[model samples]
Target chain A: MKLYDYVRSSAAYRVRIALNLKGLVYESVPISLLEGTQLGEDYRALNPTGLVPSLAIDDQGSGEGILGQSLAIIEYLDECYPEPALMPATPLKRARTRALALQIACDIHPLNNLRVLKYLTGELELSEEQKTTWYHHWLKQGLSPLEQQLGGDDSRYCCGDTPTLADICLVPQLYNARRFKLDLTPYARLVAIDQACNQLTEFRQAHPDQQPSHPGENLTRR
Target chain B: MKLYDYVRSSAAYRVRIALNLKGLVYESVPISLLEGTQLGEDYRALNPTGLVPSLAIDDQGSGEGILGQSLAIIEYLDECYPEPALMPATPLKRARTRALALQIACDIHPLNNLRVLKYLTGELELSEEQKTTWYHHWLKQGLSPLEQQLGGDDSRYCCGDTPTLADICLVPQLYNARRFKLDLTPYARLVAIDQACNQLTEFRQAHPDQQPSHPGENLTRR
Candidate 1:
C-alpha cells in the first residue's frame, strides 16, 4: 500500500497515525500541497477532491486501489485489519466515538482548512488580521463544543482507555490549533488527551516534522 | 425513536430520509433552527454543538438514548436495522459510498450551513451579495469535485442503483443548491440523481416544504 501524503495536512497525519497504529508498512508518496502538486492532472485523476492522504491498496496486481476521505480510509483500514480496532465494539459507543470525531472533522476543521484560509486572503482579499480572526473564530467554535462532548470522563483517550477514531481526529486538530496559536487552556481534557496521544509511538511517528517532505525542519523554522 | 429536527437543515433532512427509507417510524420533534431554538441551554445539553437532527432512541426505561451528528445517527440506524443497508456491502464499496457522502456532508454543507451563513452576515457584516457569493463559492468548490467523483457512472444514486447514504446526502444538498439558485447544469449526474431520488416517497416526504414547521407554503408562496 502507498499513501499519497502531504506533511502539513492534518488529514494526512490522521492516516499516517492509523497506519502506524495498525503496524502496517506503506510507502509514502509525498504530494506537496504547498507547492501545488495536488492541482496537477495526474493527482486529480487519482483523487477528484485533490486532497492529501489518499491510501492506495495493493489490489492483487490490478494496479493501485485508490481510496479518499481520511475517515473513510481509516474506517476501511480498521475493517480490513481488525487486530487493533480503530473503532469501538458496540453500536452506541461507535456512534458516540464517531460523533466526537465528526464534531471536529466536519464542524471545525473544514472551516479553518488551508484552502479556506487561502480563499479568505486571496479571493475575498481579507486582511491578515481578518484571516487570523477567522482562524481563531472557527478554532474556538469547534474546540469549545468538543470540550463539552468529551465531558469530565476519566478515560485515557478521547472515548476510552484505548485509542479510537475520536482520538485519531482529536490529535491532528490540536496540532493545527497550536500551529495557529490558539489558547488551549480552556480545553483541559483535550490538551491532556493530546499530551497522552503524543507519548505513543504511533502518534509520534506520524507527526508532521517526521514526514519526509520536511525532515526535522522544526529547527530551521524556529 | 424521536428525532430533534429542523425543517430547513440539510443535515436533519439527511437523517429524515434515512429513517423513512428504513421504514422506521420516528416522531419528528421539530427544533426551529431559524428561531435560535437550537442555541437554548436545554437543547445544548442534548447536543453540545447546538446542531439539529439528533436522534433519541427509547432505550427501554433508561431515559432517552440521544445521538448527534447525521452520519453517526444514520450509521447507527443502519447498524441496528440492517434490512435496507445504507452503506455498500464490501469495504471498498462502502468506502466509496462514505467518501461520496462525506464529500457533501462535511465539505459542502457545513461551509454553507445556516450558522455559517448567519456568521457571514451577522459578525462579518457582509452585504447580501457578499453573503450569496460566500454561499455559492463553497457550493461550487465542493460540487465541482463531486461531479468529477461521480464520473459518468449511470447509477440512479451516487454510489449504486438503490438510495444509499450518498443519495440521502445528495438530495438535501441539491435542495439547498436550488434554494440558493446555483446552476445545476454543471452537475448533470448529481442533478439526475437528485431527480431520481425525489421520485421516491422517502425523499419526497423529507423535503423541507413537507416538514410541519412550514407546510403547504410552497403553494402559498406561489
Candidate 2:
C-alpha cells in the first residue's frame, strides 16, 4: 500500500496517526501540493479529486483501485486491519464517534483546508488578512459550539477515557489552530485535552514539522 | 420515540424521512428555529449545541437520555430498529455509503443551512447575491464531485438499486436545491436518482409540503 500525502495536510496527518496507532507499515509517496505535484497527470488519474492522502492499493494486483478522501481511506484501513478498531462496535457509539469526528472533518477542517484557502485568495480575491479573518471566523464558529458541547467538565477524551474517533480529529485541528496562531486560550478545555494528546509518540510523529517536506527551517510554534 | 424538529429544517426532514421509511411512529415537538425556539431555556437543556432534530427514546424508562446531531440520532435508530437496513453490511461499502452521505451532510448542508446563510448575510454582511454565490459555490464544488463519485450508471440509486444511506441524504439536498432554484441541468444523473426516490411512497410522504406546519399555505416562495 502506498499513501499519496502532503506533509502539511491535516487530513493526512489524521491518517498517519491512525496508521501508527494500528501499527501498520505503509509507504509514503509525498505529493507536494505546494509544488503542484498533486495536479500532475499521473496523480490526477490516481485521484480525480486531486486531493491529498490518496491510498493506492495493488489489491487488484495492478494498483488500479485508488481511494481518495482521508475518512474513506481510514475506514478502508480499519476494515482491512480490524484489530485496533478506530470505531466502536455498537452503531450508536459509532455514530457518536463519527459525529465528533465530523465535527472536525466536515464542520471545521474542510472550510480551512488548503484548497478552500486558495479559493478565497484566488477566486474571492480575499487579501492575506481577509483570508486569515475568514479562516479564524470559521475556527471560532466551529470551536465555540464544540467548547460548549464538550467543555471543561468532560471526560479524558471527547467521548471517554479511551481515545476514540474524536481525538483523532481534534489533534490535527489543534495543530492547524496553533499554525494559524488562533488563540487556543478560548477553548481552555479543548486545549487541555490536546496537551494530553501531544505528550504521546503517535501524535508527536504526525506533527507537521516532523514530516519530510517541512524543511529544517522556521517551523510554526505549537 | 420523540423528535425535536423544525418543520422546515432539511436535516430534520432527513430524519423524518428515515423514520417514515422505517415505519416508526414518532411524536413531533416543533422547535421553531426561525422564531428562536431552539435558543430558549427549554431546548437548551436537550441539545447544548442548540441544533434541532434531537430524538428522545423512552425504552430506557426515562425521557432524559436521548439527544444530539441528526446523523447520530439516525444511526441510533438504524441500530435500534434493524429491519430495513439503511447502511450496507460490508465495511468498504458502508464507508463508501457514509462518505457519500457525509459529502452532503457534512460538506454541503452545513455550509448552506439557516445559520450559515444568516452568518453570511447578518454578520459578514454579504449581499443577497453574495450569499447565493457562497451557497452555490459549495453546492457546485461538493455536488459535482459527488455526482462523479456516484456510480449511477450501474444503479438507479446513489450506490445501487437499494436506497442506501446516500439516498436518504441526497433526496433532501436536492429538495433544498430545487427550493434554492439552483440550476439542475448540470446534474441530470443526480436529478434522475432523486426522481427515482421521489417515486417511492416513503420519500413522497416525507416531503416538506406534506409536513404538518408547512408554510406553503401562508407564505409563498421568496
Candidate 3:
C-alpha cells in the first residue's frame, strides 16, 4: 500500500493512526498541501478529489486501488483488519462511536480546514483576526458539546477501554485546535482523552510532527 | 423509532430517505431549524450536539436510545433492519460508496448548512451576496470533483442498482444546490442519477415538500 499523504492534514493524520493501530505498513508518498501539490494534475489523476491520505492498495486483479476520504479509508481498514477493532461490537455502540467521529469530521473540521481558511482570507477577504475568530468559533461550537457528551464517562478512550474511531478523529481535531492556539481550558474531558490517546504508541506515531513531511523537522534539526 | 427531524435540513433529509428505503416506520418529531428550536435546551438535552435528525429508539434494556448524526443514525437502522441493506456487500465497494457520501456530507453540505450560512452573514458580517458567493463557491469545489468521479458511471444509483448510502446523501445535497439556484448544467451525470433516484417511492416520500413541517405547504394550499 502507498499512502498519498500530507503531514499537517488532520484527515491524513487520521488514516495514519488507523493504519498504525491495525499494524499495517505502507509507503508514504507525501503530497504537500502547503506547496499545493495535491491540486496538481498528477495527484488529481490518482484521486479525483485531490485530497490527501488516499490509500493505494496493490490489487492483484485490477490496478484500481485508490481510496479517498479519511473516515471511509479508516472504516475500510477496520473492516479488512478487524483484530484490533476500531469500532464497537454492537450496532448501537457503533452508531454512538460513529456519531462522535462525525461530530468532528463533518461539523467541525470541514469548517476549519486549510482550504476553507484560505477561502476566508483570500476569497472572502476577511482579516487575519477575523479568520482566527472564525476558527475559534467553530472549535467552541463543536468541542463544547463534545466535552459535555464525554464529561461523565470514565472510559480511557472516547467510546470505551479501547481506542475507537472517536479517539482517532478527536486527537487530530485537538491537534488542529492547538495549532490555531485555541484555548483548551473549556474541554477538560476531551483534553484528558487526547492525553490518554497520545500515550499509546499508535497514536504517538501518527502525530503530524512524527511524519517525514512535517515542516517542523528542519527547525528541529537546526 | 422516533426521528427528531427538521423539514429542510439535508442531513435530516438523508435519514428520512434511508428510513423510507428500509421501509421502517418512524414518527417524525419536527424540530424547526428556522425557528431556533434545535438550539433550545430541550433539544440539546435530547441531543447534546443540538443537531436535527436524531433518532430515539425504544431500547428494551434502557431508555438511552437517542442517536445523533444522520450517517450514524442511518447505519444503525441499516444494521438493526438489514433486509434491504444500505451499504455495498464488499469492503472496497462500501468504502467507495462512503467516500462519495462523505464528499457531500463533509466537504459540501457542512459548508452550506443553515448554521454555517448564518455565521457567515451574522458573525462575519458578510453581505448576503457574499454569503451566497461562499455557498456557491463550496458547491462548485465539491460538486465539480464529484461530477468528474461519477462521470462515466452507468449504474442506476450512486454505487449500484440499489439505492445505497451514497444515493441517500446525494439527493439531499443536489436538492440544497438547487435551492440555492445553482446551475446544474455542469453535472449531467449527477442530475440524471438524482432524477432516477427521485422516481422511487421511498425517495419521493422523503422530499422536503412532502414533510408535514415544510414551509412550502401553505403556499401550495393557497
lDDT (C-alpha, whole model) for all candidates? 0.86, 0.76, 0.89
Task: Please state the Cα-based DockQ of model 1 relative to the true two-chain complex.
Answer: 0.78
Q: On a 0 to 1 TM-score scale, where does candidate 3 land against the true structure?
A: 0.96
Q: What is the lDDT of residue B169 in candidate 1?
A: 91
Rank order (by DockQ, best first): 3, 1, 2
Give one digit per residue, the lDDT tens place, for model 2 in A116-203. Answer: 7886677667688977887898788778777877873668777777666678888889989878889888898888788777777877
Model 3 over residues A2-105: C-alpha lDDT tens digits?
Answer: 88987778999999999999999988888877788999999999888877879998654556689999999999889888989999998989999999999999
Best by DockQ: 3
Q: Indicate whether candidate 1 or candidate 3 has the larger DockQ.
A: 3
Please identify which of the two predictions, 2 or 3, would achieve the higher TM-score against the true structure.
Answer: 3
Q: Model 2 clash pairs?
A: none
Model 1: per-residue Cα lDDT at residue A143 = 89
- Best candidate (score: TM-score): 3
C-alpha TM-score for every candidate: 0.95, 0.89, 0.96
